[model samples]
Target: MAQHVERQRYWEAQQAARQAERLARKRARSIDWSAALRPVEPVPIRTETLIAALASGLIAALLLGDGVGPGLLIAAVPAVAAAYVAARAAGRRPRPWTLVWGVGSLALLVVPALRESAWPSTLAILAAIGLGALALFGSRTWPGVLLSPLGLLEAAPTGVRWAWQGVRARRTGNARNVWPVVKAAGVGIALLVVFGALFASADAAFADVLGGVVPDVSVSDGPVRVALFVLGVVVALAAARAAGAPLRWDRVTVAPGTPRSPVEWALPLVLLNLLFAGFIGVQLAVLFGGYGNVKERTGLLPAEYARQGFWQLLWATVLTLVVIALALRWAPRSGPRDRRLVRGVLGALCLLTLVVVASAVRRMDFYVHAFGLTRLRVSVVTMELWLGVVIVLIIAAGVFGARWLPRAVMASAGATVLALGLLSPDGMVAESNVGRYTEQGKIDLAYFQSLSADAVPALDRLPEPLRSCALRGINDDLADEGEVPWYGMSLGDRRAREILRERPVKASFETCAGLGTFRSRSEY
Candidate 1:
């Protein structure tokens, strides 16, 4: 009897192992990895696309080669125009809304010419252009928006290939037609040189005018300029090709996570909702009872209390978003009861998270009010506000379904960045700090000195010593900007130069040394 029992136990264990092996094989077979690995077909290069790309490249090389300035707008115009022409030539109707984004992108490039602040304007410009590219040539879906930058990277090699193909086509198939155009251009140049030299020699005033009007061509930076031109050509080719035949990123689908039972999904979210609700209750008490009550109860100053929780609250809000995304992915979708549970639990969490977002904003507001506004403070506030907008969109998605959520979120982000650029954050910060100085009779002169040319107008409004001290650094910078070319000129730099010329700072460093504190603590 003992031997028979042992045999039966061994057989049962072997059968269980075989069953587990079968299940693993089934799971492996279900995933079609080759579908993702399949190569996409290359887009055909067209004559119109090639010509527009080369023109755009030439424009970029000419205008943007000097440096970042108003030339950014000048360079972008041709590239955008090329994309538009390429789309039309391909017999495709370009989306009208994409034109709006394109206009917004061009408008954002104007920021660098308007504001001297590097970070905010640069960030806004890059974001706007990236979103605009995605809107024009990639998917409007969430995944597509997220992956659009990668598409640009992949297109880099394709651009090189496109250029090679154009060269090859000219060499083999169109070789007979190339020499006539080259010969004609050479003859025209020869004639112009013979007549122009005679005219210049014949008239001294004409020579001087010609010399002033034409730029002095130099070979000192030849390699650098050539490299920039090549880079511009490659980038233009990539963009034009993308516009002609956009990748179908919207069709790319990610499999859903393994579904959980209703009890398994709901319990943790319900508990999380309770936790969020409890924290919100504490926030309410602090809000209604005033900081004085908090000081009395907790023995902490308003700024101290506000500072201690602001960073933590910001992280918490960020983590809560990740949690919601994961929860939605793993949610049970078996029945009406499961759907109701998800809507209730997730909706409650979203509402509570909004309160948390509000609390974070309020905390930052309190901190900013106490310490005065800086660039970092202003940037953080803007980011927090945008995050709040994202949460609201998520809630809307929960109700109306999420098909439109991704594009809407992307659009909102682009709009928010454009708004930030338009607001001229550096000027706003300077204005706010100047107002604070008026009220409190305290100022951070060193901090003002570190600001860009955008702050010059606001700082000019100060009294004698404060005004001279704040303007001293900016004056020196403007003085060094002796002769900016038309393409490299910025509105902020021009305005700053004008302001300094009207009323220059006469104070030396030693004179304004001990006038104001730096207020380094205002950073956090």
Candidate 2:
């Protein structure tokens, strides 16, 4: 009896030790990032890098040619990133991630230039660039992009320390000796203010004349603007550094589990699979019965028929992915049999989801074919296409977990964005609408009038009545071309200028919102 008791105690102690070890591992995996930011490294800044960074920022500011349009700001991303790369301490050949970032970042900047430099276009382009930068410089993945911001706190202190160290080293004086310089600056400021006020009081004409002076030549505002421009560039470069070279964060990988009953994940997945199959079967039936039957059965119009179930199917496709991922990550397995059953069920679900994806794509195509392609419609089409590719990849990964999957996906996404950039989506949209208008006499002049310069040449291909009004609208948009300097140039503006220069069409400038009008409506 004593022997048995001793053996039981030993087993219990062993289990306790295992539990403690697991807890220790968990604790080790999780870190208080806030605490470990100590002894942070100084931000690197070489003379060449500083010059490159400043030049890139200046180029961007200059490209703001029309005074800071979204296109110039966004397109500046790649230029800025290129500057960062030139400046980074590492002189080794660029990594794959960095190259992807470079391509994607530049593409993001050019997208706005290719399309209308609307606020939406600006936001989307910047977001894409930011994501690429985060992944490339920091985590090399989507989640890492999200966590990259937390790295700022560490960078902040280090940057300050580095700056302070530089000042201390350069000054060759006691730390407290800054008082003399501060006093001199304060006295100088007081003298300037006193003299300036007296001068203004003595001569009202002088003050009024100074106030009327152009900002470009204003003595008082020039120095301040220069200072502000320099400050802005510094901040931008600093942000790039923080994002690219952030301190490492703790990463925890879940441990593999022992064999267990299949009941945990099997039954639920089977039910889900059956539900997906039934849904897919219904979709197939509807697809086969034709749009007419769907229209009759659902009491929906042709337009409604095409639009119907799109959002639902999109959500379903996304949900299935999440479900499959969860099952793979957390599902209890009763060895190989349970694993196979789960994989088969998930695979079945994925295949069914592919049908849903197809249905969504078909609906989008029908809608675009009927309504003519808009930016939103084309974007959705692209999204659905990407989803289809993703589903196929997921299926393949399930069958065979290749280590190259993530890299392949990254490459494909980068390639797609680059291709889209080269293809010029705005130009394509214009081409599609013009073709549609050619076949059908119905053309929305106002909508066409609202399109960017890429559409102008396309609109020129239309018949006289449509062409006349459309050209008139475009001419009005470009009327202020003389006011904008060459530096603030845009593709749209350039194209419109070229066309106008070749054949100065006397377009009505009354109805169209000239490009300058957007400044009033700007959200920024």
Q: How accurate is candidate 2 locally (lDDT)?
A: 0.59
Per-residue lDDT of 1-524 in model 1, one digit per residue for the tens? Answer: 99999999999999999999999987775544324422344345655566656666666565555556787777666667666765666665757557666776777787887777788678877876687577556466766778766666766677668668866888788877766766886899799888877888999998877655443436886666677667777776767656665665555667899998888888998899999999999988884366687677669876687888877887887888899899989999988888888888988988998898898888877777788888888887788788889889998998999987877887788788878877888789889989998998767787876778888889889988789998887777767766565566678877888888888897767778877523343454
Write one digit per residue (lDDT tens) for candidate 2, span 160-215.
45444545654665446655756886899799778876887799998766444312
The models' CA-based lDDT, in order, is: 0.75, 0.59
Candidate 1 segments exceeding 4 Å error: 1-44, 175-217, 288-294, 517-522
Model 2 quality (TM-score): 0.69
lDDT score for residue 249 of model 2: 38
Pairs in clash, predicted candidate 2: 65-488, 75-109
Q: Candidate 2: list runs displaced more than 4 Å.
A: 1-44, 65-93, 119-124, 135-138, 149-232, 243-245, 249-261, 288-301, 400-421, 471-474, 480-482, 500-524
Would you estimate the TM-scores of all the predictions? 0.85, 0.69
RMSD (CA, Å), candidate 1 to true, equals 4.8
